[model samples]
Target chain A: MARLSDVIEKFIKSLLEESEGELELQRNELADYFECAPSQINYVLATRFSVSHGYYIESRRGGGGYIRIVCLDVDKNNFLHYLVSEGIGSRITEHDALHIVQRLLEQNYIAPKSAGLIKSAITDKAIGIPSTLKDTIRANILKSMITAVMAWQGK
Target chain B: MARLSDVIEKFIKSLLEESEGELELQRNELADYFECAPSQINYVLATRFSVSHGYYIESRRGGGGYIRIVCLDVDKNNFLHYLVSEGIGSRITEHDALHIVQRLLEQNYIAPKSAGLIKSAITDKAIGIPSTLKDTIRANILKSMITAVMAWQGK
Candidate 1:
């Protein structure tokens, strides 16, 4: 027999997938369905799901209160499609660009060496004077190169 | 006479300048060296140096515990180049993309008009794409424009 927490976790994930937007679940009701403590739901959420793990969770206190979870999907095909439309225009910040690169790496969308090369290329201070525009330019170049790679991968 | 606090501050700054990586120290030992209250060290760290001010401080209480401080040298230029080579291979957000442009403007690298043009081009309203590809294209275009600008600047 499967553990109650595992069952609850799967059940909640399924609900989140089925829902179009945010997923809201009542702790008590979920506990009743699983015949476990209300805190068990909390345990499953805290352990199996976290923001760092690509999940957003919110909860309210008091009667009829519920927990809301948002899933951050990083599917490779979907990411590629998304990249194609958001044409890199001119400027992008270092932090924001870094986040995108990190996300792609985490999702295995790009190889480690490729990611390192990208990081080093943009960081080469010899490219331009240190300024905000440099970050933007770096972001644009990264987006363009990555999109080209993705397009190539589709072949 | 130079105050003990002044002496300590100078000592720490010199240590930072000479040291590689983070600097570690003990509050009680430092207090004994200066012949002051342990809280005095805390006061100096809290007031003069902070992580937000480009310094990182970490400490622990109890036996044989110590404090560690790291000066963060955020190389905006290097980070930008790294983004170009690594980050642009995919999609990015308009907000993040704008941040890079803004940073470039602050650094006096790109003209303000160019930044504005790039921003308007990459926005969701501009792209009109429900998919995430908008971010990727936005990153790519930004990179190309920057590279062109850098090449021009070099000439």
Candidate 2:
């Protein structure tokens, strides 16, 4: 049997396909259709539709309120600029670095195995330096890395 | 990833730093801090703190005897050879490769910007392949990159 989460994901994806990649769903109705709790619907939306996964969600509450989800287009040029300029400061946490790698994977800007390599390369443990200096060093490293990746892409 | 042995090794090393490159501790005290069996400490000492990683451990087991740890200076040539042979295998994950790079950076083998460029170029994503194939390619790439780095240093 398909897992409840999997089924829910597939159903929503099917809906998205029909709706041209944007959707506004009735929260309660989705729960009723899946025969699951409203929180389960919320869970699905939270995990599967995050910005890092190339989604934009805006939810409204009360009567006539809806859950809005948009399949965001991957803007590599804009993203590369942000990553180099403001996205990475002097030091980036491993979690945030991995998040960006995940985002790149979701957008097809980078491959999955490459994502794993990038994650490993940026970690505190990998850097093997004092905690205070890691982030600043990480920032410089990531900026140069992103620029290099862009140049490799002939951008 | 944070194995008990690895955690124990890090804790001991942290204490060594504060103690000016050497430390003495009760096995039971460390076991108590990590809430693991006392034997776990011995396991970590026997494995991770071996001479190859540039650590030395001595213990006199008894009521008053303490385990002592010391950080050893690395022999760059020997360390580099070990990294190429054992630290990286036919498949080098980004973690292992990056660890080597970080060590090189710390040892002044590569400059900070050069390290970043090296990381970007050697990543599996830059190579673009299936996960199963990536490690093999990464190993080849890392070895070549390291050789290039060494050559650059000599030049």
Candidate 3:
């Protein structure tokens, strides 16, 4: 049985996919359709549709309140630089890292084999340090590798 | 002035470089030349010239005993596969991982950019786990990435 959260996430993703990575949803309508509380919608947005997951969500609270979701666009020229300074920062979790990698793959910034290499390198299993330090190291490694790619690509 | 151990390491490396990665040395004689204890020579070999560092050492004991050091050769065809099964195994330290990357770079099996990416992926900073689990994860990641490279290269 699929969890409500998972189902909601999938539904929203499908909507985004269909709408070309941008969409607006009425929280009340979605809640009613799923027979769930609006809070469930909020939960889904906060967790599965967060910036870390390559999404930017804006919620308006009013009579006409709506949730606006936008997928982060990868600017071909500056994305690697952006990722180093902003996307990865100094710390990153495995989930967030994987999401970023997924986005890169989707954008065709890296080949499938390269994507696999990145995933293998950044996976939680590979970064087998104390929980406190894992994210920091993952960030460093990811940044360095991205820089390497940029150099290779002559960017 | 460089430390005795460093000097000895460099001297041996130069010898190997000159000899096409194979050399034989009598420990006592080298120690006398360096005006140091034989144990010091042993220290340099143990620390700087281990198999993990991409050099293999064989010691023959007795009057005719000699220390033979051979650099690990990367067989262009099956090296990546060999690394997954034999070289990387279940666990790997940063030092060992770096050495493998270096060997690949030297052998021209990977481009500089790909080398940079591989190094970044396997580095300790990237694998931010506990010391105990770090090596195992590093091994997994290195193996996976190598497999990725192999695929990309159509090997």
Tens digit of per-residue lDDT, candidate 3, span B1-155 = 87889999999999999998789999999999999999998899889876446565656676467888876554543777678658678888899899999998999878776787898777777655446767876777787677556545332
Winner by lDDT? 3
lDDT of 1 by residue, A1-155 (tens): 24567678788878876895369888899888888888988898986677644678998989878898988776677675665456344555655565566656766776554454344334424223344456555655566556545654544
Per-residue CA lDDT of model 2 for B53-147, tens digit only, reads 55655556544578877665445455555665466767778777777778888988666655665677556555443446556655655654453
lDDT of 1 at B94: 84
lDDT of 3 by residue, A1-155 (tens): 24678889999999999999999999999999999998999998998777756789987898988989999985765988889879688898887898888877767887676676787677666554446677777787788777767776653
Ranking by lDDT, best first? 3, 2, 1
In model 3, the number of clashes is 7
Candidate 1 lDDT score relative to the true structure:
0.63
Off by over 4 Å in 3: A129-133, A152-155, B1-81, B89-116, B119-140, B147-155
Which lDDT tens digits does candidate 1 get at residues B62-86? 5557888766553433444555556
> What lDDT does the true structure give each of the candidates?
0.63, 0.68, 0.78
The reply for model 1, stretches above 4 Å from the true place, is: A1-61, A64-70, A87-89, A124-128, A152-155, B1-155
Residue B59, candidate 2: C-alpha displacement in angstroms:
32
Per-prediction interface RMSD in Å: 15.1, 14.3, 13.4
The alpha-carbon lDDT assigned to residue B145 of candidate 2 equals 49
lDDT of 2 by residue, A1-155 (tens): 23587689889889988998899999899999889999998888787778766788998999999999899886798888888888776667766776787777767776554454455556555444444645655555556567766765642
Model 1 is docked with a DockQ of 0.03
